[model samples]
Target: MPTPASLVSPRLPAQAAIAVPTSRIHALRTGARAAGLIAAGLGMLGLLGGWLHWPPLATLGAGSVPMEPNSALMSLLCGVSLIFALRSPQSARRSTCPLAFAALAVAALTLSQWASGVDFGLDGLLVQGGASPPPLTALAFIALSLGLIAMCKRGRIHTQLSEAAALAAASAALVGLLGLIFSVQSLGGETRSPPSAVALPSMLAVLALAAGMMSARPDGPVVSVLASSQPGAQFGRRLLGWLLCAPLLAALLQAGVQRGWVGGSSALALGVFIALAALAAAIVSSARRLNAAALHCELELGQLRQAAVVFRSSNEAIVITDAQANILTANRAYEDITGYPVDELAGQNPRLMKSGRHDTEFYRMIWRELHERGAWRGEVWNRRKNGEVYAVWQSISAIRDDDGSVTNYVSLLADITSIKEAEARLQHLAHHDPLTDMPNRLLFANTLERSLAHAKRHQHRLALLLVDLDRFKRVNDTLGHPAGDRLLQVMAERLHSKLRSGDTLARLGGDEFSVLVADAGSREEIAALAGKLVANAAQPVWLEGRSVDTSISVGIAIFPDDA
Candidate 1:
């Protein structure tokens, strides 16, 4: 059986498949070590940079500039975090060393940034401005963004940490936004410190955006992992993760600016973070909705399959045709009735079932009526697969498309052979007498009427002879009705045999009958035919091993003049 197409996503490239597992382990390990280094750097940066102190081994003995040591710590923080991230991709969280390390490193960096006192604007961006520090901070965040995107996309690690990635994105945005706001605003009279404090939070936001994009792959393993998260309900849990980080980062940025970080505005960075977090939350919510929808669609698919099976197995003969009157499908009953396999019949002309009993005009009339009335329910003769013909009661209708175009045709048919036989029997009952099996008074009257009308128009004589048996009732009384009926049947046969084939003889009832001979020569010929009816009908009929005699009294009537 063919596998359902929807069940699987297309395979990733070979490089993508192999590189993910290999690189991610190292990346995670590096992330751990890097986080530790960055965290320590953050603590030092917190104590020394915020105070603008040039440690004793400081280059050129720091004053307001706070050279070398401050720059060294900031650079180290960025570098260590990058290493942790770079090595962490080992397909995704292969070893907790990398994941836990990176998380702790970032957390340590966050706390250091928090501890640094938000009033730091000492790098000349605030009271005394610098030439390249602000531009450098922006450039660094941009580069980090690009690096994470390249790694996540190429490694295809989004599948490994779906929930975490989404939560991470939201958290990053909040931190970035809050940090930017707090860093840009100056509040209580406080000693502002250094440029790197404000810049750190912005770097984290760029990382968060990369992680968000990575986790969006439809079949990525990240989703399976996300499904395993706790401490949050299905919808709100993800949003909650993000909200927790924003306020802390915001307060830190505010404190950092008071202590003198870069004088540049932090507001823009904070706004970017908020936007990113909202977007990430939206993405996760949409994914859950889609999964629910897919489940519903799967249930509907099963019902449709069951319905198809039912349609195929129905016992009533059903034929479905294209608009052009070609077979499209047929059911088991159709095959049973026509002795044709549905597979063999599909794409063949449906007209193959038409027997030649009807002429062209007859079929045209049927089509005309059907098209006009939207349906035709009547009897027809159709051929079986073996060239045998059968009578069927068929109903055909047009199947229309939404645009009112006739797209198909459907027919339901059943065998009516027995019904036809019953109809023939009814007709025999109407025209002939039951006891004698001869044309009855009703048939003789019809024949007389037609013959008289034709004779008048053609200037010819027509005659009718009334027949009565002399003693049919007495025979019935003596020999029983069975013998009497036999005598009547014999008399009817004799009268029929004695007449010319064109003449008609009928027993009206009991002893009564009528003979009709049309286009007669004259009264003499009419008299002769009537006399023969009397003589021949006198023959005895055999019944139960005995002979019963029957005689007739005939009254003759000639058309035009009763002579």
Candidate 2:
């Protein structure tokens, strides 16, 4: 677990919060629901007019003829769907089944009327010739049905579905409105015909449906993404709005120009001016968002640069390796300690530094610990580039991906060669004499105990001699302590030279020494060795450019005989 301070990055407070903003989404959804209700009202009005045979209603419905029962029925179904959309969004989301069935029925009746001049059993019951709905009406219903299907199947509107639904509704409205305008305009021309009967109500209904769908959930994935404080989302949302409005605006502008209500040149200039204004708004918004993103990236880059600085300047060696234990890179300290350049180590296995002091089982144990615990730390002996084996204290950690698979390994090591050497020197000094560099009494006693046990087990005799230097204090008092020390070293060397390879010689203190002669055949042999040691010590008299006389008194003990 990380501390709270560690969880937060000091450099990036702006990016710390990830919660979505909902104010814009709520406003958009409310507007869409309101539009859907307005569309439903218009549809109902059209339905009532066509059923009551009122001329005003008929004009809005079937353009001077009463709407056929089939047309009225389809309008009623669309009105119901819009009402469902407004009242119960969740139920409306899953209401595609009924809407699809109704759309298919409307499509079938319209096709029958278009192809065979058949009325689908309503020939005599409603107004005759103008009963069939226009092709755009069928298309509108199909688009709505598809939109509903998309919404229901996905359970929630995603990006692609929202785009498709918005495009379908926008296209339906554009086609119907454009067709109605053209029909009205053509009335003033030589060729005069009534507008398609389905135009007004169907256009209004689909527009309402599109608005409702867009506002169904203010914080839905589509709206949330589009309204986010991100450059790409802002640009895309603006672009989509421009595309939806551009065709209708252009068509209206062209109609005004053709009707002489506006000059063509003036209209073209106005269109261009409006387009540039929209483009400027989009650019400014995108620029502001992108500037924020750039600043965020710069802060992150600074942090990375700081981390790089620390990595390069650290005293300890650091190595990074791939999953297979091949070295990828090493820091400057690694190069200094290992005596290998970064380039030389690259693409080479870490085993190239193995000292061969540890057996294969040792390496196997290291790998096992790493796999189980994701890290291993201990003292390891590795060979330097100059072929010298040196000790290092190393820690290796596994770096893993989000899925918990190992991706890389980071090893941190420090050379402990000097420390190990110091520890060995301290241990030797603890059990040896400082002046003569000989085993002290503590070590000699341990050796004597072991020797005595061995002799008793093998049924052999061992002899011990304790020698005390005579007249050594007089030389130290007259010639100085340095001369006395040199004399002691010389004496120790002489005694050591006289002993057999298997014998032990140790300095007990200032001028007293002890020797252990193991496997001495008899007391006669021990007595002869003691006399020889005594004579050798008595002859050593050279010190400080003068002949200093030094003599020793020897005391001998036979281990089993004394016992």
RMSD list, candidates in order = 20.8, 14.7
Estimate TM-scores for all models: 0.45, 0.47
User: By summed lDDT, which 10 consecutive residues of candidate 2 come out lowest?
Assistant: 1-10
Tens-digit lDDT string for candidate 1 (118-223): 4343333311232112322333333332333333433344333433443454444444345344443212222345323333422333343334333223234443
Candidate 1's TM-score reads: 0.45
lDDT of all the models against the reference?
0.56, 0.71
**Pairs that collide, model 2:** 29-215
What does the lDDT read for residue 265 in candidate 2?
90
Best by lDDT: 2
Per-residue lDDT over 75-154 for candidate 2, one digit per residue giving the tens place of the 0 to 100 score: 45654564465445477665644764675566565655656755565433444333555655666656665555454443
Clashes of each: 58, 1
Off by over 4 Å in 2: 1-303, 453-461
